[model samples]
Target: MNAQYKSCIEAVYRCIEACNVCYHACLKEEHMSNMSKCIELDRECAEICTLALHSMQRSSTFAIQILSLCAEICDACGTECKSHNHQHCQDCAQACFRCAEECRKLIS
Candidate 1:
């Protein structure tokens, strides 16, 4: 992979980890009802990031398209996580935003 792809892959992996962590943490929150959006977004973000990583790894023709979608999902997840006060949420948000940026770089 090229240096750009290498960085994007790293960011995608980190985003996946963060999203997974946030998903579990949100489930454990006392007000589970309030964390529903965060949980949903976290799961979506992780799934998309995983797909993006795989597509990029294989150098698929649709890799750029997948990255575009992944960036959108990451942004949504980041926004949701940022609205929460938990440290896990904050960390996930940061990772999501960074991943989105990296994905955008690959697409553009």
Candidate 2:
């Protein structure tokens, strides 16, 4: 893979880690019901981010497609997390937004 693509993959991995941490934290909150959607999105985002990262790392022909899906998932996750008032949700939203931007760049 190219250096630029490797950098994007790293960013996605970082976002995946952040999202996973936030997902667990959100699940432990007292008002878990309020964060249900955020938690779900976090899990989905993390999985897609991992897939995209790996695909890019290997320079798969379908890397662009994976990046597109990652972007979409990140957008959804960011929106869902932003709907909550919790700190974890807010952090997750920021991470998701960043990941989405990175993935978007890879797509283009």
Candidate 3:
């Protein structure tokens, strides 16, 4: 993988960690009912990021395509995360935004 792709892979890993943390954090929030959507999206984003990371690691020919989907999910997850007051959600949003931007470089 090129440096850009490598960097995106790292971002994907970080995003996975962030999403996992954010999901669990959301579950523990006082207003758990308000965070269900965020939790769902967080899990989806994490799964997509994991797939992208694996695809990149294997140097799959479709890695770029996978990253494209990952980027979209990351952006969506970030937007959802930003709706919360929790620090973990904000942090996860930032991570997702970074990962989304990095993933864009591969296809752009």
Candidate 4:
């Protein structure tokens, strides 16, 4: 794969990993109620990121479309995660933002 594609894929992978980790960590938090939004967004972001990764891997005609949605979800997830104080949430926010930026590059 080309450098650009490789880099974007790596970003997506990192976002997916971060989202998953954050989701589980949030679930285990003492006050899970407060992390409801973060948990929901993490699940959605991870699912969309997986789709984006697969679409890019196959060079699908809808890859850009899928990535557009992925970017949107990543932005939302990042925003939600950024509001939290947990280390996992902060890490997830960074990854989600990075993934959104990478996805935007291809779409633009």
User: Model 1: runs farther than 4 Å from truth?
Assistant: none
Q: CA shift at 83, candidate 2, in angstroms?
A: 1.9
- Steric clash pairs (candidate 4): none
Each model's lDDT comes to 0.95, 0.86, 0.93, 0.96
| lDDT at position 38, candidate 2 | 81
Across 1-65, the per-residue lDDT of candidate 4 in tens digits comes to: 44557888999999999999999999999999999999999999999999999988888889899
Q: Model 4, residue 39: displacement in angstroms?
A: 0.5
Give the winner by lDDT: 4
Model 4 lDDT-worst window of ten:
1-10
- Reference-based TM-score of each model: 0.96, 0.92, 0.96, 0.97
- List candidate 2 stretches off by more than 4 Å: none
Clashing pairs in 3: none
Q: What's the lDDT for residue 82 in model 4? A: 100
Question: Ranking by TM-score, best first?
Answer: 4, 1, 3, 2
TM-score computed on alpha carbons, candidate 1: 0.96
To one decimal, what is the Cα RMSD in angstroms of model 4 from the true structure?
0.9
| Residue 93 error, candidate 2, Å | 0.8
lDDT of 3 at 18: 97
The true-versus-predicted C-alpha distance at residue 73 of model 3, in Å, is 0.6
Estimate, for each residue in 34-99, the C-alpha lDDT of model 1 and write its tens digit. 999999999999999999999988888899999999999999999999999999999999999999
> How many clashing residue pairs appear in each of the predictions shown?
0, 0, 0, 0
lDDT of 3 at 8: 88
